[model samples]
Target: MTASFAAPRYIVDGGTEATSVLRRLARAGWTTREGFALPENTWDVSGTRLVLFGRVADADTAELAVLAAARGAGVVAIADAGSDVGRALYADLARVGPVSVDPDAPVAGESDEPASSGPQLAPEQRALLERLAGGETIAAAAAAEFLSLRTANRRIAEAREVLGVRTTREAVLAYLRIRRETREG
Candidate 1:
Protein backbone atom coordinates (compact mmCIF):
# COMPACT_ATOMS: atom_id res chain seq x y z
CA MET A 1 0.00 0.00 0.00
CA THR A 2 1.23 3.47 -0.86
CA ALA A 3 1.16 6.19 1.75
CA SER A 4 -0.86 9.28 0.96
CA PHE A 5 -0.20 12.78 2.25
CA ALA A 6 -2.74 15.47 2.95
CA ALA A 7 -1.80 18.99 3.93
CA PRO A 8 -2.63 20.04 7.45
CA ARG A 9 -5.67 22.25 7.88
CA TYR A 10 -5.64 25.11 10.33
CA ILE A 11 -8.18 27.59 11.68
CA VAL A 12 -7.92 31.17 10.36
CA ASP A 13 -9.92 33.92 12.04
CA GLY A 14 -10.11 37.68 12.35
CA GLY A 15 -12.04 40.76 13.46
CA THR A 16 -11.85 43.37 16.22
CA GLU A 17 -12.80 40.94 18.98
CA ALA A 18 -11.25 37.86 17.38
CA THR A 19 -8.46 37.36 19.91
CA SER A 20 -10.76 36.53 22.79
CA VAL A 21 -12.88 34.24 20.62
CA LEU A 22 -9.73 32.50 19.41
CA ARG A 23 -8.54 32.09 22.99
CA ARG A 24 -11.75 30.34 24.06
CA LEU A 25 -11.82 28.16 20.96
CA ALA A 26 -8.12 27.33 21.19
CA ARG A 27 -8.77 25.75 24.58
CA ALA A 28 -11.06 23.33 22.73
CA GLY A 29 -8.10 22.20 20.52
CA TRP A 30 -8.24 23.98 17.15
CA THR A 31 -4.57 24.77 16.60
CA THR A 32 -3.64 28.08 15.00
CA ARG A 33 -0.15 29.49 15.09
CA GLU A 34 -1.13 32.25 12.68
CA GLY A 35 -2.81 34.40 15.32
CA PHE A 36 -5.87 36.58 14.99
CA ALA A 37 -5.53 39.90 13.20
CA LEU A 38 -7.94 42.52 11.92
CA PRO A 39 -9.22 41.28 8.60
CA GLU A 40 -7.97 43.82 6.07
CA ASN A 41 -8.19 41.81 2.87
CA THR A 42 -9.87 38.60 1.88
CA TRP A 43 -7.50 35.85 3.01
CA ASP A 44 -6.90 32.67 1.06
CA VAL A 45 -8.77 30.09 3.12
CA SER A 46 -9.16 27.05 0.88
CA GLY A 47 -6.57 25.28 3.01
CA THR A 48 -8.17 26.22 6.30
CA ARG A 49 -10.58 24.01 8.22
CA LEU A 50 -12.49 26.98 9.57
CA VAL A 51 -12.80 30.70 9.02
CA LEU A 52 -14.07 32.65 12.00
CA PHE A 53 -15.24 36.24 12.11
CA GLY A 54 -15.97 37.87 15.42
CA ARG A 55 -17.58 41.32 15.63
CA VAL A 56 -16.48 42.74 12.30
CA ALA A 57 -16.15 46.51 12.31
CA ASP A 58 -17.55 47.35 8.90
CA ALA A 59 -19.48 46.03 5.92
CA ASP A 60 -16.27 45.43 3.99
CA THR A 61 -14.86 43.30 6.78
CA ALA A 62 -18.11 41.39 6.94
CA GLU A 63 -17.99 40.74 3.22
CA LEU A 64 -14.41 39.58 3.48
CA ALA A 65 -15.41 37.12 6.22
CA VAL A 66 -18.11 35.62 4.04
CA LEU A 67 -15.74 35.35 1.10
CA ALA A 68 -13.13 33.58 3.17
CA ALA A 69 -15.77 31.19 4.55
CA ALA A 70 -17.03 30.42 1.09
CA ARG A 71 -13.57 29.53 -0.08
CA GLY A 72 -12.65 27.60 3.06
CA ALA A 73 -15.98 25.72 3.03
CA GLY A 74 -16.49 26.08 6.79
CA VAL A 75 -17.07 29.10 8.96
CA VAL A 76 -18.28 30.37 12.34
CA ALA A 77 -19.46 33.93 12.72
CA ILE A 78 -19.75 35.23 16.30
CA ALA A 79 -21.45 38.48 17.11
CA ASP A 80 -23.74 40.02 19.66
CA ALA A 81 -27.27 40.63 18.38
CA GLY A 82 -27.56 43.75 20.46
CA SER A 83 -24.47 45.38 18.97
CA ASP A 84 -24.45 47.11 15.58
CA VAL A 85 -21.18 45.56 14.39
CA GLY A 86 -22.30 42.10 15.41
CA ARG A 87 -25.65 42.56 13.71
CA ALA A 88 -23.94 43.77 10.55
CA LEU A 89 -21.45 40.89 10.37
CA TYR A 90 -24.16 38.33 11.11
CA ALA A 91 -26.41 39.85 8.48
CA ASP A 92 -23.70 39.82 5.84
CA LEU A 93 -22.76 36.19 6.50
CA ALA A 94 -26.43 35.20 6.49
CA ARG A 95 -27.04 36.83 3.13
CA VAL A 96 -24.42 34.62 1.47
CA GLY A 97 -25.09 31.41 3.39
CA PRO A 98 -26.94 30.14 6.45
CA VAL A 99 -25.32 31.49 9.62
CA SER A 100 -26.12 30.21 13.09
CA VAL A 101 -27.04 33.31 15.08
CA ASP A 102 -29.49 31.68 17.47
CA PRO A 103 -28.69 28.88 19.88
CA ASP A 104 -31.34 26.50 18.52
CA ALA A 105 -30.70 27.12 14.84
CA PRO A 106 -28.25 25.26 12.58
CA VAL A 107 -25.01 27.13 12.92
CA ALA A 108 -22.40 27.91 10.28
CA GLY A 109 -24.21 26.01 7.58
CA GLU A 110 -23.35 22.41 8.43
CA SER A 111 -25.70 21.44 5.63
CA ASP A 112 -23.03 22.56 3.18
CA GLU A 113 -21.10 19.34 3.78
CA PRO A 114 -21.11 16.08 5.66
CA ALA A 115 -20.29 16.07 9.37
CA SER A 116 -17.84 13.22 8.71
CA SER A 117 -15.71 15.69 6.81
CA GLY A 118 -15.70 18.02 9.80
CA PRO A 119 -13.17 18.08 12.59
CA GLN A 120 -12.93 15.25 15.09
CA LEU A 121 -14.52 15.97 18.44
CA ALA A 122 -12.40 16.79 21.47
CA PRO A 123 -12.46 14.13 24.20
CA GLU A 124 -14.23 16.39 26.69
CA GLN A 125 -16.75 17.50 24.09
CA ARG A 126 -17.43 13.93 23.04
CA ALA A 127 -17.82 12.93 26.67
CA LEU A 128 -20.34 15.68 27.32
CA LEU A 129 -22.34 14.76 24.26
CA GLU A 130 -22.31 11.11 25.24
CA ARG A 131 -23.74 11.99 28.61
CA LEU A 132 -26.38 14.18 27.03
CA ALA A 133 -27.26 11.35 24.67
CA GLY A 134 -27.82 9.18 27.73
CA GLY A 135 -30.39 11.78 28.86
CA GLU A 136 -28.40 13.84 31.32
CA THR A 137 -28.96 17.56 31.61
CA ILE A 138 -26.02 19.81 30.69
CA ALA A 139 -25.96 21.13 34.23
CA ALA A 140 -25.96 17.60 35.61
CA ALA A 141 -23.39 16.45 33.08
CA ALA A 142 -21.23 19.40 33.99
CA ALA A 143 -21.50 18.57 37.67
CA ALA A 144 -20.72 14.95 37.00
CA GLU A 145 -17.68 15.91 35.00
CA PHE A 146 -16.57 18.31 37.75
CA LEU A 147 -16.79 21.20 35.29
CA SER A 148 -18.25 24.57 36.07
CA LEU A 149 -21.47 25.61 34.36
CA ARG A 150 -19.61 28.19 32.29
CA THR A 151 -16.99 25.67 31.24
CA ALA A 152 -19.67 23.12 30.36
CA ASN A 153 -21.63 25.61 28.30
CA ARG A 154 -18.45 26.73 26.64
CA ARG A 155 -17.62 23.15 25.72
CA ILE A 156 -21.09 22.67 24.36
CA ALA A 157 -20.68 25.82 22.28
CA GLU A 158 -17.29 24.61 21.07
CA ALA A 159 -18.78 21.26 20.15
CA ARG A 160 -21.51 22.98 18.22
CA GLU A 161 -18.92 24.99 16.37
CA VAL A 162 -16.82 21.93 15.59
CA LEU A 163 -19.72 19.64 14.65
CA GLY A 164 -21.41 22.43 12.74
CA VAL A 165 -24.62 22.14 14.73
CA ARG A 166 -26.59 24.36 17.04
CA THR A 167 -28.04 23.61 20.48
CA THR A 168 -26.95 20.88 22.84
CA ARG A 169 -29.67 18.53 21.60
CA GLU A 170 -28.44 18.77 18.05
CA ALA A 171 -24.86 18.36 19.20
CA VAL A 172 -25.82 15.17 21.05
CA LEU A 173 -27.57 13.77 18.00
CA ALA A 174 -24.70 14.66 15.70
CA TYR A 175 -22.22 13.03 18.07
CA LEU A 176 -24.22 9.82 18.13
CA ARG A 177 -24.63 9.80 14.37
CA ILE A 178 -20.94 10.40 13.75
CA ARG A 179 -19.99 7.64 16.18
CA ARG A 180 -22.43 5.18 14.67
CA GLU A 181 -21.27 5.87 11.15
CA THR A 182 -17.62 5.68 12.06
CA ARG A 183 -18.13 2.32 13.72
CA GLU A 184 -20.13 0.96 10.81
CA GLY A 185 -17.66 2.11 8.20
Candidate 2:
Protein backbone atom coordinates (compact mmCIF):
# COMPACT_ATOMS: atom_id res chain seq x y z
CA MET A 1 0.00 0.00 0.00
CA THR A 2 1.08 3.55 -0.70
CA ALA A 3 1.33 6.05 2.12
CA SER A 4 0.29 9.70 1.97
CA PHE A 5 1.28 12.43 4.35
CA ALA A 6 -0.16 15.90 4.74
CA ALA A 7 1.70 19.14 4.10
CA PRO A 8 3.39 20.69 7.10
CA ARG A 9 1.27 22.89 9.29
CA TYR A 10 2.87 26.33 9.85
CA ILE A 11 3.06 28.51 12.95
CA VAL A 12 3.42 32.31 12.73
CA ASP A 13 2.92 35.14 15.16
CA GLY A 14 4.18 38.50 16.52
CA GLY A 15 4.32 39.95 20.02
CA THR A 16 6.79 40.81 22.84
CA GLU A 17 6.58 37.20 24.00
CA ALA A 18 6.41 35.87 20.47
CA THR A 19 10.12 35.61 19.79
CA SER A 20 10.64 33.19 22.64
CA VAL A 21 7.51 31.30 21.70
CA LEU A 22 8.57 31.03 18.09
CA ARG A 23 12.00 29.89 19.20
CA ARG A 24 10.46 27.29 21.46
CA LEU A 25 8.21 26.10 18.66
CA ALA A 26 11.08 25.90 16.20
CA ARG A 27 13.05 23.89 18.75
CA ALA A 28 10.05 21.62 19.14
CA GLY A 29 10.31 21.00 15.39
CA TRP A 30 7.21 22.87 14.32
CA THR A 31 7.42 24.59 10.93
CA THR A 32 7.48 28.38 11.27
CA ARG A 33 6.59 31.05 8.75
CA GLU A 34 7.10 34.85 8.90
CA GLY A 35 4.41 37.44 9.30
CA PHE A 36 3.72 40.29 11.78
CA ALA A 37 6.41 40.78 14.44
CA LEU A 38 5.40 40.05 18.05
CA PRO A 39 5.12 43.69 19.18
CA GLU A 40 2.81 44.21 16.25
CA ASN A 41 0.60 41.56 17.96
CA THR A 42 -0.52 40.04 14.69
CA TRP A 43 -0.53 36.33 13.89
CA ASP A 44 -0.97 34.70 10.51
CA VAL A 45 -1.04 30.94 11.15
CA SER A 46 -1.99 28.22 8.67
CA GLY A 47 -1.75 24.43 8.35
CA THR A 48 -3.73 21.22 8.92
CA ARG A 49 -4.60 21.80 12.56
CA LEU A 50 -6.56 23.93 15.09
CA VAL A 51 -5.12 27.45 15.29
CA LEU A 52 -6.13 31.00 14.30
CA PHE A 53 -5.49 34.78 14.46
CA GLY A 54 -8.31 37.25 14.82
CA ARG A 55 -9.27 40.81 13.92
CA VAL A 56 -6.29 43.04 14.24
CA ALA A 57 -7.77 43.79 10.84
CA ASP A 58 -11.21 42.81 9.59
CA ALA A 59 -13.55 40.09 8.29
CA ASP A 60 -11.26 39.21 5.40
CA THR A 61 -8.49 38.11 7.73
CA ALA A 62 -10.89 36.15 9.90
CA GLU A 63 -12.40 34.48 6.85
CA LEU A 64 -8.96 33.51 5.64
CA ALA A 65 -8.13 31.96 9.01
CA VAL A 66 -11.33 29.97 8.90
CA LEU A 67 -10.57 28.86 5.39
CA ALA A 68 -7.07 27.78 6.35
CA ALA A 69 -8.36 25.71 9.25
CA ALA A 70 -11.08 24.23 7.06
CA ARG A 71 -8.41 23.23 4.59
CA GLY A 72 -6.60 21.43 7.47
CA ALA A 73 -3.67 23.85 7.72
CA GLY A 74 -2.99 24.46 11.44
CA VAL A 75 -3.84 27.91 12.83
CA VAL A 76 -2.52 28.16 16.42
CA ALA A 77 -2.29 31.87 17.29
CA ILE A 78 0.66 32.09 19.64
CA ALA A 79 0.71 35.89 19.56
CA ASP A 80 -2.60 36.31 21.36
CA ALA A 81 -1.95 34.00 24.31
CA GLY A 82 -5.49 32.58 24.21
CA SER A 83 -7.15 35.37 26.24
CA ASP A 84 -10.75 36.59 26.45
CA VAL A 85 -10.00 38.21 23.15
CA GLY A 86 -8.20 35.07 22.12
CA ARG A 87 -11.05 32.78 23.12
CA ALA A 88 -13.30 35.14 21.22
CA LEU A 89 -10.99 34.95 18.26
CA TYR A 90 -10.89 31.16 18.37
CA ALA A 91 -14.65 31.14 18.73
CA ASP A 92 -14.89 33.13 15.55
CA LEU A 93 -12.45 30.84 13.82
CA ALA A 94 -14.49 27.94 15.08
CA ARG A 95 -17.65 29.84 14.06
CA VAL A 96 -19.25 28.64 17.29
CA GLY A 97 -17.87 31.01 19.94
CA PRO A 98 -16.44 30.35 23.44
CA VAL A 99 -13.65 28.10 22.15
CA SER A 100 -10.80 28.26 24.60
CA VAL A 101 -7.14 27.28 24.87
CA ASP A 102 -4.72 27.65 27.76
CA PRO A 103 -2.33 30.52 27.18
CA ASP A 104 0.59 28.69 28.76
CA ALA A 105 -0.18 25.38 27.10
CA PRO A 106 2.37 23.71 24.87
CA VAL A 107 1.14 24.25 21.32
CA ALA A 108 -0.05 20.84 20.17
CA GLY A 109 -3.70 20.77 19.07
CA GLU A 110 -6.25 19.59 16.52
CA SER A 111 -10.01 20.32 16.63
CA ASP A 112 -12.26 17.38 15.83
CA GLU A 113 -15.30 18.98 17.44
CA PRO A 114 -16.67 21.36 14.87
CA ALA A 115 -17.51 19.93 11.47
CA SER A 116 -17.06 23.06 9.37
CA SER A 117 -14.16 24.29 11.47
CA GLY A 118 -11.90 21.50 10.22
CA PRO A 119 -13.72 19.38 7.73
CA GLN A 120 -11.65 16.88 5.78
CA LEU A 121 -13.02 14.96 2.84
CA ALA A 122 -12.62 11.22 2.72
CA PRO A 123 -10.95 9.96 -0.46
CA GLU A 124 -14.21 8.59 -1.80
CA GLN A 125 -16.00 11.84 -1.07
CA ARG A 126 -13.28 13.71 -2.89
CA ALA A 127 -13.45 11.38 -5.86
CA LEU A 128 -17.17 11.92 -6.10
CA LEU A 129 -16.78 15.64 -5.74
CA GLU A 130 -14.11 15.72 -8.40
CA ARG A 131 -16.24 13.63 -10.69
CA LEU A 132 -19.21 15.91 -10.21
CA ALA A 133 -17.01 18.93 -10.83
CA GLY A 134 -15.98 17.30 -14.05
CA GLY A 135 -19.68 17.20 -15.04
CA GLU A 136 -20.16 13.47 -14.60
CA THR A 137 -23.63 12.22 -13.82
CA ILE A 138 -24.20 10.58 -10.44
CA ALA A 139 -24.41 7.07 -11.95
CA ALA A 140 -21.23 7.60 -13.89
CA ALA A 141 -19.48 9.03 -10.87
CA ALA A 142 -20.61 6.04 -8.82
CA ALA A 143 -19.17 3.74 -11.43
CA ALA A 144 -15.95 5.69 -11.43
CA GLU A 145 -15.66 5.21 -7.69
CA PHE A 146 -16.83 1.61 -7.90
CA LEU A 147 -19.70 2.29 -5.56
CA SER A 148 -23.36 1.50 -5.84
CA LEU A 149 -25.78 4.38 -6.51
CA ARG A 150 -27.15 4.19 -2.96
CA THR A 151 -23.67 4.16 -1.49
CA ALA A 152 -22.69 7.11 -3.66
CA ASN A 153 -25.66 9.12 -2.47
CA ARG A 154 -24.68 8.29 1.10
CA ARG A 155 -21.16 9.48 0.47
CA ILE A 156 -22.42 12.70 -1.07
CA ALA A 157 -24.71 13.17 1.92
CA GLU A 158 -21.76 12.81 4.26
CA ALA A 159 -19.77 15.37 2.27
CA ARG A 160 -22.69 17.76 2.36
CA GLU A 161 -22.92 17.39 6.11
CA VAL A 162 -19.22 18.02 6.60
CA LEU A 163 -19.27 21.00 4.25
CA GLY A 164 -22.34 22.44 6.04
CA VAL A 165 -24.33 22.50 2.83
CA ARG A 166 -27.81 21.27 1.98
CA THR A 167 -27.26 20.52 -1.68
CA THR A 168 -24.86 18.47 -3.79
CA ARG A 169 -23.96 21.53 -5.88
CA GLU A 170 -22.90 23.45 -2.79
CA ALA A 171 -20.83 20.47 -1.66
CA VAL A 172 -19.08 20.44 -5.03
CA LEU A 173 -18.49 24.19 -4.80
CA ALA A 174 -17.18 23.90 -1.25
CA TYR A 175 -14.87 21.07 -2.20
CA LEU A 176 -13.67 23.04 -5.21
CA ARG A 177 -13.03 26.04 -2.99
CA ILE A 178 -11.01 23.85 -0.62
CA ARG A 179 -9.07 22.43 -3.56
CA ARG A 180 -8.26 25.91 -4.77
CA GLU A 181 -7.21 27.14 -1.34
CA THR A 182 -4.86 24.20 -0.70
CA ARG A 183 -3.39 24.53 -4.18
CA GLU A 184 -2.77 28.23 -3.67
CA GLY A 185 -1.06 27.48 -0.38
- Which model scores highest in TM-score? 2
lDDT of each: 0.55, 0.54
Per-residue alpha-carbon lDDT of candidate 1 for residues 80-116, written as tens digits (9 for 90 to 100): 5556766655544433334443232222223334335
Error of 2 at 94 (Å): 27
Compared to the true structure, candidate 1 yields what TM-score? 0.38
Question: Model 2, which residues run further than 4 Å from truth?
Answer: 1-117
* Among all candidates shown, the one with the greatest lDDT: 1
Name the Cα RMSD for model 2: 15.1
lDDT of 2 at 127: 83
Question: In model 1, which range of ten residues has the least summed lDDT?
Answer: 1-10
Clashes of 2: 13
Cα lDDT, model 1, residue 77: 48
Model 1 score (lDDT): 0.55
Estimate the lDDT of model 2: 0.54
Q: Model 2, range 33-131, lDDT digits (tens) per residue?
A: 542222223232233222223233344454555455544444444435344544344444433111223333343332224333346766568889999
